[model samples]
Target: MKILVTGSEGFIGKNLMAELRNRKYDCIYEYCRETDSTLLDDYCKEADFVFHLAGVNRPKDQSEFMDGNYGFTSELLEMLKKHENNCPVMISSSIQAELDNPYGISKKAGEDLLLNYSNETGAKTLIYRFPNVFGKWCKPNYNSAVATFCHNIAHGLPLTVNDPSVVMNLVYIDDVAEELINALNGKENRVEEFCEVPDVHTITLGEIVHLIHSFRNSREERSIPNLNDSFTKKLYSTYLSYLPEDQFSYDLKMNEDYRGSFTEFIKTPDRGQVSINISKPGITKGNHWHHTKNEKFLVVSGKGVIRFRKINTDKVIEYYVSGDKMEVVDIPTGYTHNIENLGDTDMVTVMWANELFDPEKPDTYYLEV
Candidate 1:
């Protein structure tokens, strides 16, 4: 399918483009920063679907919001009306558009413009109202609560809750992308009306902050054996300051089998064996060369660097990895390798071997520092 996507440089647009690319669909992207109507129309002429996502998400001034969001959308609809039997236009509106904010008002106007154009030209138009979508690769300045929370938690900052009782819907970016793809693949008649993409989960701000604190505290406790009362009391005191007056029970649960940096273990399956370990920041582990044991490394938490040197050769390679990225770095046998945790937190890894782990006659050969 030939798809023309506007706002290709934006977060949602980038994700949608990647999804379409993975599905083997032909995608043409036009960034509003670099191109405008003539280029967009030419691309739309050959498209089976046109996803209109170009607009100002939020602006400090009301006039800028109207010009950038409403005006841009109106112009695009006008250009689409000129085309004969133009492809179905999927306009990405926001849940904010349903509210009274200036940003919301402009977005609502954009939606109305698309609907009016669709009515006049008899073209297919689909509208999507999205909630708080959060995930990796998010732009930091977008005022997304999820991004702010993730940033704060990752950096070990104190979480502040404006209201403990207010609950808001939160949706992961992957889920939102999945829903959009489903809509694209469905019959055109099925998406005739404006569709509201509901969040999969609803959580309160206070709950989110506490969950992060608990996860961090649990990880710290696992690494520090025989922690003194003073340190524990200090951590608890800091946590208490971020909460309400009443004692609130924590409903958040941590994954015990997470086996990340703070939780390390060795698992032996009948078919194969897997060993994992956590490295604290400024520490280096796994400097030994493996003879026949191949391993997969993932930086489960925090940022880190991996350096590998080929045996009997001057060739060397280095890679930087961070949290929740599924990038697997394969370590070939007969190579000397080491990884260093560069961030302020723990760096975790899960390693799988084809055979059982042996300490004395291990496949690893240590090299002098």
Candidate 2:
């Protein structure tokens, strides 16, 4: 299907266009701010579907709001009429359109025009009065407070929140794009005369800041966020999008000894902890067993021997592990176990314990295996 997307380079437009293309829809005519204005007429004439996403929310002059939002919308509808195109049209509108402000008025005017056109030609139309949409590719330092805050915080820049107490209704960009695709297929989430993206979330400005800040501190605290929470999962995904390309990785604290070093990779409240361990040749680490805590150790580099022994039995079970032949040895509770590096080089092992190590109640006792 031939699809025409206005404001193709804008945040929402970019996301939607990318999603459409990823779905293998190649007949897309994109008109961004740089495109020649007259080309919109040809695009409107040829498109089987129109995504009227072009509009001004942060223009330098207030009058530009009406010109870009309402005026351009009227022009596109007129072009569709002139070309005798009865294609389905979807307009991106803001919930602020319910207000009496100039921007809202312009957006409402655009919505009215689309509704009237749908009536006039009996063409399918979708009007989404979306709340604050946040996710990857959203412009920073503009209208979206979420975008600005994420960019600033991710870059270590100072931010100014005029009203931290203010609450916001947020929708994720992926959800918005998905809903738009659904609308294109006539499977819209209609509410009254307009449509809505399902599962919009509400959070206070201060609360959002706290959640994002916790994501930043996770590195130092060696803890993972409660990703089971939907809002936090989406917000964390958005936060990572703002990180600089060069700063994708952070250094972890490493504990070193005569044997080698161990670094905690991730720690989760319900899933326990994962650590990377390195042992020098002829070095033995972890000659200990836990009463209740359990672990799985995988040798990823060099050769190693993992030996296990029951608390009372004299029988010793040994597993010779090599990096070329990766294997995981599970350490059961009450079974004393130790890993000894047997190769001439250092051995690297990835360890996953069912519980995080606790100093006060370690539940660990050293014993020869």
Candidate 3:
């Protein structure tokens, strides 16, 4: 099917067009400010479905809001009428349409025009009264507070939230795109008079600020936010997208000396911590037993032998590990354990403990295995 999308470079339009192409839609006519006016006539004449997303949200002159939002919408409708194309047309309207402000009044005008066009041409119209729509590709420091907060917080800039108590209705761009696709398939969320996005999340300004801030802190704390939570997972994904291009990777502090280097990779509140332990050839580490803390060691590279002995028992247990065959050796509580590099090269072992290491209460007793 031939689909026409206006404002194709915009946040929602970009996401929608990408999804449409991914779904194998071959023909997509993109109309924007840069496109020639005559081409719009050609696209309108041949297009089967129209995604009318082009509009002015922030204009230097207040009058431009009506010109860009309502006036442009009228022009598009007239083109459709001239071409005798009565295919479905979906428009992105703001929740502010009910208010008396200039932008809101202009959006409402566009909505009324679409409804009138539908009445006259017997065409189907889908109008979405969106809230603060957010996701990746949204411009920062513009109209969306979520995009601004994500960009600023990810880049260590101060955030500005005037009213922390103000509640915001948020809709993810993916959901909006999916809903539009559903409209193309003749299944849309319709309330009384207007079509709507089916799902939305409501969060206070202060809560959203805190949630995004915690995501930044997770990098240092090594504790990941709850991905099982839908909102947090989506918000974290959005935050990562706003990270500066140059700052994609970070350095992990390595504790090094003579034997090799050991670095803590990640830590979780309930899942414990993961660390990489490197040992030179013939070098041995551990020789300690914990009363309550247990660990599991997996040798990922080089050859190694893991030895363990109970505190009071004379019996010794040994496990030969190597990079060729991966295995995890568990060190139970009250058992002294040690790992020695047997290969000519350095041995690398991944270690996972039950809790974060504490210097004050080591809970470890040194003993030979």
Candidate 4:
């Protein structure tokens, strides 16, 4: 079915789009705001379903939150009521809507607008109140509490808990995305007023921190570093060594199959080298681009595909080679690339580069194809 997704640039919106695409659903993204009404109306007119997930969840002040979350949603709902042709709407609300924060108050108002509009227009309205969502592409400082804790623990920072006793439900973003896809596919008559999207597990802040530390510690033990002597110290060293020399950064294990440890690598030098080994076929390393480093790769063994693309351009080049005919592939600095093992044998490659990996800098970009 043709579906319209609002706030398609935000974290949840991005995850939802990925999930929908995986399910083979026809979906279109639209950023809804005061200035984008015409574009939004055009999308709504053609959609069989509308996932209204736009608006800000946090603001510097209460008025900003009100304007961003409540006001924007109210206006969107009014426009939907006038322009939409009875397309079902799935509104992504927040658990904060039940709290007293300005974010919550604004979300409550947005929900009311959706329900009232649905009652008047005969449009199906489904509201999802999400708890703290974690996993994959979550930005620590801006996303949620789990991200903050994970970011700290990944980098070997002591999980600083303002209150360790406070319990929060942490749901995986994949789970939430799957639920959204399910809702989108289900019969419209089965839609409910509200759903508390349950998490696979609920954890305390302290537990979350410990989990990350444990994972990172386990990784260091298994890696070439073999830091079984003192996992904490080794992790700290590993983190410091890999961190961008000029800036502070951390790495979160977003994918389920992240084989290497979740140790946060910080760069402390303008130029350095970090390496990993892929011992099996089907292992892929990095679909990311760096703006700073001119990376070079040597095929230690086996066969693989080295795919690279220039930034902001559609020009892409793929190089396929095997162990018997090994060659060093030079990826031009400031390009996106990934190495995937295509041969039946293990592909051992060494990534030696001079660019420091920085998450905040516009260095790494992700591509699906």
Candidate 5:
């Protein structure tokens, strides 16, 4: 199928185009601000589907709103009519189109034209009156407050929230792209007269700021956000995409000593904590037992022997682990355990604990294995 996508370099257009190509759809005709004007006519003539996403969000003059939003839309539809190409056309309209402002009025005019064309030609048309859309590739500090906030916070810049109580309705770019592709397949989520993307998140300005701030602080805290919440998960993913290229890696606090260092990698409330442990040759670590805190230890390098002994028993169970043959040794409750580096070089072990370590109530008791 030949698909023509206007505003091909735009935030939504870029994402949708990328996904289309990723899905192996190669017959895409891209039209952007830089494309030559005469090419649009040829594109419309051959396109089996049209994604009319070209429009101005922030124009210098109010009149440009109508020209860019309504004028360009009319031109595209007219060209399609000229070719008798009544293929399905999907236009991106804004929820603000219901308002009386110039931008809204222009968007509403574009919507009316598309609906009328659909009625006249009996062509399939999908109109999405979307709210705020946020995701990767969206330009920052221009129109979207979410984009601006994510970029600023990721860069350590301060944010200015005019109204904390202001509510925002957001749709993720992935969802929008998915819904559009679904429409192309004739499975659209249609309301009475318009189409919609099923997944919409309603949040407050204050709440958004709070979540974004938490995402920035997660690096130092070595904690991961509760991704079980879909909104938080998507927002965190968006925030990470905006981080400066050089700031991708952050230093973690390493508890270093003669026996080498231990570093916490990630901590989660439900999934437990992951850490890295390094032991010097001939050094033994972890002669401790827990009442409830359990752990899994995997020797990733060098050689080691993980020894365990049941409380008040003389029986000792030993597992000889080597880097050549990786294995996970589970530390069960009521059994004292220790790992001794038996190799000539340092041994690296990846460790996981069921819960975060707390000094006030450390569930650890030291005893020889």
Candidate 6:
């Protein structure tokens, strides 16, 4: 189907176009400020569906809001009417339309025009009054607070919150895109008069700032955010997308010794901690037994032999491991274990502990295996 998308260069428009292309729709007519004015008439004549997303949210003068929002919408509907085309039209409106401000008033006017056109021509119209939308491609420091916070915090810039108690309703860009596609398939989630993106995240300004700050600090702390929460997962994904191109990678502090180096890769409170361990050829490490803390070790490089011995028992259990055929060895309580590099090259092992090690009360006791 041929789809015409107005304001195609914008955040929501770009996301919707990408999703449409991803779903294998190729004949899309994109109309933005840069496009030639005469092409809009041809696009309107041939369009099977129209996504009317053009609007002026932040203009130099207050009058531009009405011109860009309502005036342009009227012109587009007239062009479609002139061509005798009554295609399904979907518009991206703002939640601010319910208020009395200039921007809101302009958006409401556009909505009324679309409804009138639909009533006169019997055309299908979908209007979505979206909340604050955020995602990867959203521009920072513009209209979106989430975008600004993600960009500033990622770049080590300062953030200012005038009112911490203010609550914001947020909708992710993916959800918005999905909902638009569903509307194209005649599956819109309509309530009374307007359609909506089903998943909305309600959070305070203070809570959002706190979560973003924690995302920034996670690098230094060698920790991962709890992604089980849907809002946090989407927010974290948005935050990482704002990282400066040159600052994509950060160094992790590695504890080095004569045997090799060990670095903690990631730590989580509920899950566990993961570390990378290296040992030189013929070097042995981890000659200890844990009272309660258990671990899983997987040799990823070179060859090694893992030896385990139960306390007060002489029988030794050995597991030969190599990078060619990797295996995980579980270290249970009451058993002393050690791993020795048997290959000529250095051996690398990945270790996972059930919990973070506390120096104040170490449950480890040195014992030979």
| Candidate maximizing TM-score | 5
Ordered list by lDDT, greatest first = 5, 6, 3, 2, 1, 4
Model 4 Cα lDDT, one tens digit per residue, 125-165: 88877777666566667767766655666555665578877
Clash pairs, model 4 backbone: 242-266, 243-265, 243-266, 243-267, 244-266, 244-267, 245-267, 245-268, 245-269
> Per-residue alpha-carbon lDDT of model 2 for 109-169, expressed as tens digits?
9999999999999888999999999999998999888888889998899988788999999
Poorest stretch of ten by lDDT in candidate 4: 259-268
Stretches off by above 4 angstroms in model 6 are none
What's model 2's TM-score? Answer: 0.97
Residue range with the least summed lDDT across 10 consecutive positions in model 1: 222-231
Rank candidates, TM-score, best first: 5, 2, 6, 3, 1, 4
**lDDT, candidate 3, 37-119, per-residue tens:** 88999999999999999999999999999999999999999999999999999999999999999999999999999999999
lDDT of 5: 0.95
Return the lDDT, model 3, position 2.
93
TM-score of each: 0.59, 0.97, 0.90, 0.58, 0.98, 0.96
Of 1 and 2, the candidate ahead on TM-score is 2
**C-alpha root-mean-square deviation, candidate 4:** 17.1
lDDT against the true structure, each candidate: 0.67, 0.92, 0.92, 0.67, 0.95, 0.94
Report the error of model 4 at residue 232, Å: 20
Candidate number with the higher TM-score (1 or 5): 5
Full-model lDDT, candidate 4: 0.67
State the lDDT of candidate 1 residue by residue for 1-369, as single tens digits: 777788887778888788888888765555567775468667755677778877786667679888988887776766666666466788888888889988899889888888887888877788887777666566644667655665566555665668877786766666667777776776332434676554455777776666546644543332221224332333333333333335233332233433233323333234344445577778887677877878888767778888888778777788898876877888888778888888888777766666556677688887522
Clashing pairs in 1: none
**Predicted candidate 5 versus true structure: per-residue lDDT over 1-369, tens digit per residue:** 999999999999999999999999999999999999999999999999998899998999999999999999999999999999999999999999999999999999999999999999999889999999999999999998899999999999989998999999999999999999998889989998899999999999999999999999999999999999999999999999999999999999999999999999999978899999999999999888999999999999999899999999999999999889878889999999999999999999999999998999999999988
**How well does candidate 5 score on lDDT at residue 326?**
74
Please say which candidate is ahead in TM-score: 2 or 3: 2
Instruction: Give the higher-lDDT candidate: 4 or 5.
Output: 5
